[model samples]
Target: MVSVEVLNNHPTGGALCAKGRAAPEIVASPRRLTVPLKRTRPRGAADPGWVEVSWDEALTEIANRLGAIRAESGAEAVAFGVTTPSGTPMVDSFEWVERFIRGFGSPNLIYSVEICGWHKDFAHALTFGRGIGFPDYDNADAIILWGHNPARTWLAQATRIADARRRGAKVVVIDPKPNGSGQQADLWLRIRPGADGALAMGAIRHLIATGSFDADFVDAWTNGSLLVDRATGRFLRADALWPDGAADVFVRLDASGSPVPCDTRYTQQSGGRLRGVLSVRARDGRMISAATAFELLVERAAPYTPARVAELTWLPIADIEAFNALLATRPRLAYHSWTGVGQHTNATAIERTIASLYALTGACDRPGGNRWPVPPPTRALNDYNILPPEQQAKALGIAELPLGPPAKGWITARDFSRAVLEGEPYRVRALVAFGTNFVVSQGHSERNKAALNALEFQVHIDMFMNPTAESADFVLPASTPWERDALKIGFEITQAAVETVQFRPRMVEPVGEVKADYEIAAALALKLGMHELFFGGDIEAGWNYQLAPLGVGVEDLRGHPEGRRFPQAFRDEKYAVTREDGTAAGFATPTRRVEIYS
Candidate 1:
């Protein structure tokens, strides 16, 4: 069908162009005025009377009202919420948004931690002092992927993973589903979900039962050598002995009485002596002799045999042993896990279990192993990192905003919801959400909506009117990525090839009468007389000032969309040790050699 019409600009500022080939019918204001206005509110016992207004009025009310609430009821009375960065293309902007909310000081900075990457972070941190990010694409010999489906969720990551395989990395995928990435893997170990820990443990047993365990590495570089005191329950040490408590499993206070950082052992790149002692005690709390790394590995892994893992996980004994056999080879391995393992009841413990595999194999902080990603400078503005201290405090407050202490102990996101709904400690009153998609994101949608509806103040920001936006008292239209400006620092992984950095430019106008989140923040600060507290001056001017010191101006970024890259940057090189008297240093553990035993 064809329609032809010459028309003036519409009242909404949209051009009144006639429809061509396949198009929707367009009616003018006359049709709008004749129809009864669609009912603004649904029939409900818990509706926050809806009101229509101009953007100025909306912003003014939100800024003033929220500030007033904080002044009168204390910061605890308000909640600042932002959920997962699930569907948005503005992955980089989230870091900025998090800083903005924390700067606001509501203390309820709820994020997509338990839902997204907590398990991975915790597990990797235990072994490598950081979460496992992928190794460089060309360097991997064998890649074992468990509990991650990057294609559907992280397309960019999937591309890199595929690139690695094309470069000769042997890809082994362990997952229940025939996911897009898994289907392309050379080896697919399809076990039931939630049984990964059992599978990994079974591998450990096989490695131990067979002679393929890396005894030299385990003896020199791990806590595996330390023996466990079953009766008194403390790690056996060469010197002092202490009764075991819940937190006393690993490291303890040194001679200076300061607690020896638990993961320091993983960071040691060479042979060293440990200042703190591992200890075991008798029933009467008397000292017993210390054991070596061999003692710890044997004792801790005793309960997780092939048959026991089969029983716990419902996997066959044979499959478990095969996995165990592969692990026994002591090949350099990189491990990663995500929400699938973290969203359960025993998330933290599960993470610790996975972490042990890395430490056992001496793969932490090595080349061709998983390490944190380091972003190149060409991708970023070399500006002085400056954001107000109050703002910093506000962002961290998000984790603490529920008032008093968290009623229920922390575990997973589901547990957090249970604590809120049950009001074990107190009620969850006011909620100000940014980029939160309660419908699809939450594990339980019906219950999440119920909890959201019960809030006193509900605000949302988005480019479109999604279910979450419809439930809000105020809806602030946020700009898409192309219309905004900011800096993004990705995690550092490995020093692979040339250090490359890139930037994307805003390609179009903001969707509607929306604003960049930072500008929105500035406007609110101006309205609330908090300009000095947040941006120091006008937000744009503040941004200009920040840019000037970095040897570039606003014009440079706006004109050059493609970012600069740094050449010949040192990334993965030998870690250095320094001496007190102008000489290279040695390893700093108790046994000068890689301590096979402490």
Candidate 2:
């Protein structure tokens, strides 16, 4: 392409960061890999005879090698790899890549998610079957940016926060190193690194101590009133109270301080005033001491006072108190976290504590707070269940660390190294990586190098020849996003953002024999005899399928390069709304609530 310019909605459509502004350069770079390369020398050699080959030859070789490995070692021997999409053109084909992996029957996907987007994309689901949500910054009254500096990361969000600040919204930024945005905050908490959990707990303590937590929300939408057996640290089940009661039924205390049998049957408010401690009679005629979920949480958070947190975080007591005071205000409390709070060993626990702390505000699905705005309908892309259970069971780390990344078919670099180097769980002989530069992006560069070299066969698909691709037996060229006509579902920050859809028209042609990620995956799938699964390599057909729910088609999107707005709008405070079935719209959690105690 000769040049590129901002497409509609134009300047206000969405602000651009430096990375976005450099798109033209990224597409027309002098270093663009235009041809397929085949390594004809031994692994770890200084100069692998780089030979250019036809796409047919490259695809045939990759298909044969990957197929043979899968046939011999049950598909678990070949691990597929992907990089984070947020920072690259990989976003356009993220779903298609996963589909290809599943269609190929490999349960392991070597993705750099453990320290990038995992906390915001998966860990939060443990508490409520969902992850971090889009913050309603436009309608927000107060914004608590915990470990998230949108100015440096999210330009559109930064613009919204600036507008909120101009309208006098209270802005409190928590980061070790305050940036320009944090500097502009009404209050910036210079917290010590890795102490976000303590600060979150301190905030929770303050909310509860000042009587600022949403009691009605807590009673109705959380497990705060559920009784927990103090001895076993488990929910006191109904089977403990009666011989015939189901184990899934838990005990709850009613308004009259009476023990009541509870299940996930009803998600509405329970007018219970249970707190502190009490003893309940069991089926075995024993008195078991129990505490309400609320009391247990309160007890857990009791020790993390502002003073205590000041020592743990190195922030002044007054700063913690000031944050407490702001959180106690009547305005909606909107908060967010990023990788900063998710890179450490105790990141999960820290994130969970922050999640629990945020639950106390009752700001979810509300105006001026964090929310999951319902988007215009689209067909779901992920269908990992297509892989048989036996294949799924071969995920590298699932057998040992059941709750880790492997539980969801994701592979950490450490596990990938182990599978390739040590073959602890199973050996990974071949690797097909798309846009993933494990050398620069993942931890332990030396270990990753060894693992990459140890692979019997490796195929890399990327625009530039990075260090990670040095070990590849074949290096296939990939097209830039500018050369791909990809449909963007939504901006996903607010309801308005979700209502708008865009079809980013391809601006340029591939430099040489390069192909888009989807094209490569589709061709590879066909070569592997998975023609039906890949829609016969027809990408637009898949795009049309995804657009069916919105009464739109790929041609319609192609006609509107600026964007097209859907008719339906997002609804707010969803849990408070009674449905036609006479039941409230609850959360996606097992308990159908925010699940504070889960």
Best by TM-score: 2
How many backbone clashes does every candidate have?
A: 36, 0
C-alpha RMSD for every candidate: 9.5, 2.0
- CA shift of 123, model 1, Å: 4.5
Candidate models: Cα lDDT each: 0.51, 0.83
Candidate 2: worst 10 consecutive residues by lDDT?
A: 3-12
Q: Which pairs of residues clash in candidate 2, taking residues 3 or more apart in a chain or in different chains?
A: none
Query: Tens digit of lDDT per residue, candidate 1, span 290-407?
Result: 4334545555567887778878777677766666655666656655566667666456556666666655665554666664444443322111123344433433223553221121
lDDT of each residue in 245-277, candidate 2, tens digit only: 888877788888877887655665467863748
Candidates' TM-scores? 0.73, 0.95
